[model samples]
Target: MTTTPDPGAAGDDRRLHPWSWLFVLIGSVRQFLVPLLVLVIFGGRREDGVQLAVAGVAVAVLALLAVWRYFTYRYRIEGDSLFIRSGLLERSLRQVPFSRIHNVELRQTLLHRLFGVAEVTLESAGGSKPEAQMRVLRMGEALALERLIRHRGHAAGDATAQAPEEDAQTLLALPTAEIVRLGLVSNRGMIVVGAALALASQVMQDNLFRRAFDFVRGEASGYVASFDCGGPSLALAAIALVLLALALLRVFSVLLALVRYHGFRLQAHGRRLTVERGLLARVRSSVSRRRIQAWTLRESVLHRLFRRRSLAIDTAGAQLQGGEGGQSREPPELAPIATPAACDALLQDLLADAAWPPRDWQPLHPRAWLRLWLGDLVVAALLAAALCWHFGAWGLLGLLWLPWGGWLALRHARFAGWHVDARLVAVREGWWSRHWRFAEIDKLQALQLRQSPLDRRFGMASVWLDTAGAGAASPPLRVRHLPEAQARMLYVDLGREIARRRLRW
Candidate 1:
């Protein structure tokens, strides 16, 4: 007789189902208040006695049903997959295979922690939401489940593991010193300034500032009224000092957050890359070699001052979580950050022995800068003219913004560049500093080759690559001023890859 053990049975032993009593108790507690409140209102001596009894019985039935519903829900593991069976009226089954799992996120809410339960979210490549969420599980089981699924998917789209070791490319981790530096470099002071401004605006009853704050918070409107300035200049001075203090606090906060995530590390462990960072809530993110759709290394003006660059990965999967937009394929999740020069060296080394090719090319045409300049100038002029026509001299104050717009436009144009190769297309752009980024043809999601009337007049067009994981972030790559033929070819290539993936789906 064959002696193979049942894989499903082994997995079931490690599987967990939440305490049914928890759900039932939650339902019971919530239900208790409503009926009790109604009884207090309606209960009386003679006429309402029967009605009260009926209401009490109805509430008891509902509570019992809720308890039964909770007990009926169950989940188990089937080898490298998760199986869920849940229903009170009609049965339903959800199966999530390990290969399709994108991320296994563990969340511990306050109640969950108090109850010793952890929520496990199994995100997938195709689903709009997590394919499976064990809403509640013992902490131990949740951790084990995360480990098993991550380990079992070694052959799937993971990158860190498959990075070529023989090539001797530098792998980076944020050191304590660097992390501290990053924290210092971060602009946390701005946050404190903003907060103080908001509080002061509230006290002063500045509707404009209050509205701006409310907009960011995604809330409904609040009462707006003017404040009485009863205090004198000394009071104003004290307020100013408080504002200054708040600004300092914000700076520290930014530094602390940066330091916490500083010295970020990325290590290749066969086929997946694992990233760990946190000041408070530790985060571990992983990406596979095959999922790398494109790469972007960006330098802001401040980063230039420090001779540093921030690197972000634009991959084939959805963006890293906490993304607020409707689900779609997103730009790459950040792998690790490094210096600009280090990025160039790292790219060269990593792609040196790869099956596909890397890129080398010229910056965008010089005329591109002129186009940027004119676009900004035209926009400013139109806006100024419109304001002058509408609001008169008060509107002309807006035109004071022209010089700043011009500087920003020129800065943007200065940094935009593009490179071409048989296997890859790289487009680089930024303001005051540059980012060199590329996407391989096979990994392209969708291509938009667009020409506005102005662009056509200038014999210019833009090419945008819509890869995976844009989430709520800005687009991953956009190359303006490419030749029409080149844009067409790119569009066709990208379309084919998108179609292939759709067919697979």
Candidate 2:
């Protein structure tokens, strides 16, 4: 490991690794791949030679630009801030103060590892983009930079004088078995399959649906010819084929999980929490304990089958990158998959103050079931009416949805609840795919009390709590279907508590 230089020193500019130009070139190629493919496939006219020459010139220009970028980009650490200067025709300089930096991310792809280099990104709160991004730096230099930022608040002399290796307590580490369990509990395979099908539809000249149907028909014909069987046998063969496809999908999911979380580890170093994971593309991200805005515990039917759950956290800088090409913006996962007991213990260890899994979960209003059922009833009635208009009395079958919806609503009402303690407020919903979302009283950014027309009829209302850095996909922290009086009281009390406490993030 390379020791970081004194950040207090001035005029020590540094350029990125020499191989950064290659990475830049690769990125440019990816952006232009489609156009290049078009030229290769269709440029066969009389001016073919001229077109090829133009393409070659363009490639050369891009290569030169990549090299130029490498030569121009420079950074230096000076007095509690990082100064960066880049661009030629569009000259610009940026200074990022250490106090404002919230997260430091290091990513290393397989190619980066081969070259002993990594990409670094510095994130801050409320930023639409990273405060600073260094394309490629020596692995040791990247670590040194991370350390420098991690201890920027320390006295100037201690920043660089600290030992290279700080004691880190490993909070969680996942083995291959745990990763496999995560694969089984996740729907990543389905997502991958959907994306692949979409890509095939766009890239293949033939109609994708037609191609699939023809392939399936040919396979069925071959199977029937080989077995010399009738409808029953053909049906069985089709079932077998479907089962085989499902098995293949599961295997793919397992492989993906293995590749992404192969050596996952979460460690605590003083007040910082660091997560390191991935096989081919390693990522190490660190966030301060005070930066976390909310916590979530997730469990699905699949998780129950495996007796496992996952924990994730929303940080103040979670969305700082805003879609950076090489960086992920998803909330950090503390445990991808762990035994329920293990997850609880980890939560207790981290939170210590707020009790993990609140014991006294207050149920919603007794008529909350009716409120839920009525909402679904309106949707089901509209659907049944649409079906009835299209197909005579046969549409009455659509009404069957009413009973099923009512049953589901009742179950959800029974399972959904909320809990409030001095330090934290927690809410849980959903019976089949349940999740518990919580945030400290000091972390709550806003509160809302909502009452729909139907809710009014039932004399019920809902309380919603907002937290900074909550992912768009995360469920709202809502206590729904509470008695109007209770909801109002809870809302006012929470608002007062939030106002009294200083916001942490």
Candidate 3:
């Protein structure tokens, strides 16, 4: 005779939310009905009443079965892992470790928003598989689950590393009003919303649209009038009126877009960064100081004229990772948190608060000037010649910038400089619009020393520090025009530190 498994062990493997199938059945039935109805309508050759009834019964039965299976789906927590068991005949179990969690994102779709449900997603860094996602969670439960994970996963040293609760000063905290102003100035929502409205309108008017087809085939458009214009002047007037209406609608769309995306705010509370934005659907995201991968400071042409800059942080795998960082060695992550001067001030304040020693300031090497100009000249000349050959006289526009932009690039490259200390590395680059990025040496992942053929001839090399996720696939801090030997020595030092401080996954 064989001994049975312990009841505790059996119970640990049990699942919850057996009633979740009710929602799933409802959703499946809703999804199946439209296609079934379409088939009934289009299969005109059949004796439809009997066929329709049989199909309806089949759909209903399948929907019921789906609902039953959904309700049977469950999950259980065992030690530091969560085990999910799903499917009816083809049952399976998935186990996820709490330590594997990198980020827990709560998603609210239109349906979830209406039902007050949430979708919880657990992301793992450098995982072999995609992140695990749990759907159909109540909002409160999802948040609670996320909090529990964070509490469990946070390192023991995290508490002591936090800035002093009593003495810590808040800096660069954006007021709600300022957030609103920035949102308006940025106008991202206006562009996005307008495109959405245009798409929606096109879909509604298209003949292939489901609703449009239904309208035409059913009694939905019986009273609609057909346009039969006889005069050119009246047609022209109508066209003009339509254009005017479109212009007014565009203006209104912009206003609506602005309202919905207003009041963006970012604050530095001790070592953590907090961002909150959106008018209708507010979002609040927070990250600890140590999690930040890089820092980016930017100024657009308009902002440059206004003497303002945006400060952003690059948190690897965060929202800021997709964009290109202008003249920066670091991967794009955080950015445009504030204007130029404000960002610089914020950086200074952050360094002081962290108790990190300041970096040793140094300008771009003198050889950098020659390299910049030579590279720019060669590139610009080739581009100009190509444009002229293709476009004939019209390519003068491209030719106009042959020397001008190249000269500017060279000038800017000369101004680019870097500084390093025992704890921090800061790189300053760009000309009229400058950028300053700073990170701790402990955060770096790798160091690269490079030498071009011309650079070898010049006896110079470029040094790059790969910070956290910054490298070939991402952005990193690169300082060009160092002596070859000097770059190698620095690379050696960085590699040694990287080995000492590196934490393996």
Candidate 4:
């Protein structure tokens, strides 16, 4: 049921580990937990018999399938391609040419850590998920397979996929201290805590959390009935509770960062970047320099306070969703935390041949502040008025914080700038959370110039770019609220760039 970590285990051979059933068992439990929880919440004791029967059937089927999967799944390298055989009742054989593979990732879950095995995920272009996934291979073998695939991909065309030798230069390595810093700089603490609270809320009525909730709701006669508190005291108590929750969430977030980014390292091999990280579930993944579509530099409120930035790249592999990419799906990250100078260096290193620096930043329209923040200003005014109407003199305190929102709008206006160079285009925006994003000028799949009713009134327009497979959520680059002439000029320039520069992707 349990296995010890074995770092030196060789994965050069093609075989699944005997202990992979443990992973299967865990997976089955997770798959069932949500539905089981829902059933218990809805049916209670009345449907206990049906629940037990359904659970029993589900467990038995999952267990049998797990065993069969472990027995049936096998992966091997044959000549220039990787071959996989899986499934019991309906056997399937898949062969992937090295050229077609975009990325190969080695992921180790808690099970892999225990059994000294890793999951190998192969990703190709245009699919719902990863092309193929070989679970529970020895760590050494996984690396070897990835290296072989990289070599094949290189021989086929690209030379800088990855080099799994000992002499690759280390680009960045984050120690435990930086991981803690990353946790502190991240805003995910509250999200984790909120998720846990939501999970607690779904407990069965007879369960401990449910009982506690009922008591809090005055089910316990003395709980709320005996509460004799002034309005100010109640408000203070509510605030205290909120702070306590946030504190706990932050602690949880720190632990998550510690586990996730323990021993995180980035290495460079020619034109390839390799990343290895995680404490319990280690991952080793590599991306080609050419595959990267764009770069994003983010500085959250906490990050700004700490003077740190998180740099990430959106590669073809990150955007691609072929078949079942699974663990191979994560995007390449330069550094989770880095200084401004380090960021500049990393960006330069990545774009060594293309362009050195972008052109001078041209700011958005001067009246962009009114266009961007007018709605927020109206909402703030409405809130202040409503509060004053309800609480009279006391509500006037809301006006004290009104200036903060106005100041943030000013900050947003000041930070909004864009630049277009010979090879790259960049955009910078945001107030509390600052962002600077860059994309290749040549890779512009679509360029749009538009004016909304408000923009028309202000005689302004916006210009944005898109890459292949990129959704509306995050375009490669967008510069909003520019003057109509400037927006149209940039739009025409991009069209010329698209025609002049040959597209690689």
TM-score: the better of candidates 1 and 2: 2
**Where is model 1 more than 4 Å wrong at Cα?**
1-73, 87-90, 107-118, 136-139, 154-171, 183-246, 249-252, 255-264, 315-320, 323-337, 341-359, 382-404, 485-505
**Candidate 4 off by > 4 Å:** 1-15, 18-22, 37-43, 46-50, 87-92, 155-157, 160-164, 203-211, 214-244, 319-331, 354-359, 381-403, 468-476
Candidate 1, TM-score vs. the true structure?
A: 0.67
Show where candidate 3 strays beyond 4 Å. Answer: 1-73, 77-100, 109-111, 128-130, 159-274, 282-288, 314-336, 339-359, 390-397, 470-474
Q: Please give the CA lDDT of all the candidate structures.
A: 0.59, 0.83, 0.57, 0.74
How far in Å is the alpha carbon of 42 misplaced in model 2?
6.5
Give me candidate 2's TM-score against the actual structure. 0.89
Best by lDDT: 2
Query: Sorted on TM-score, highest at the top, how do the candidates line up?
Result: 2, 4, 1, 3
Per-model TM-score versus the true fold:
0.67, 0.89, 0.64, 0.84
lDDT for model 2, please. 0.83
Pairs in clash, predicted candidate 2: none
Task: Rate residue 267 of model 1 by lDDT.
Answer: 52
lDDT of 2 at 257: 97
Weakest lDDT window of 10 consecutive positions for candidate 3: 1-10
Estimate, for each residue in 1-505, the C-alpha lDDT of model 4 and write its tens digit.
1222322333232557776665666677786788876765565576348877777788788888888889888766666777788888999888888777776778887767767788777877566667877666777667766766666775332754454466688888997888988988776677776787887666544477766876776654464345698778767766877798777877878998998889898887666678889888887877766667788888888887878898887766565432232333334667989877778888888787655445578898998877777767677777778899999977767665557776777889998899887888889989788888888876677788888998999999988787653433343578899999989988998888888877754
Compute the lDDT for candidate 1.
0.59
Candidate 1 per-residue C-alpha lDDT over 86-162 given as tens digits, one digit per residue, 9 for 90 to 100: 77889887777777776555655456666766666666555456566555666666666655665566443341233
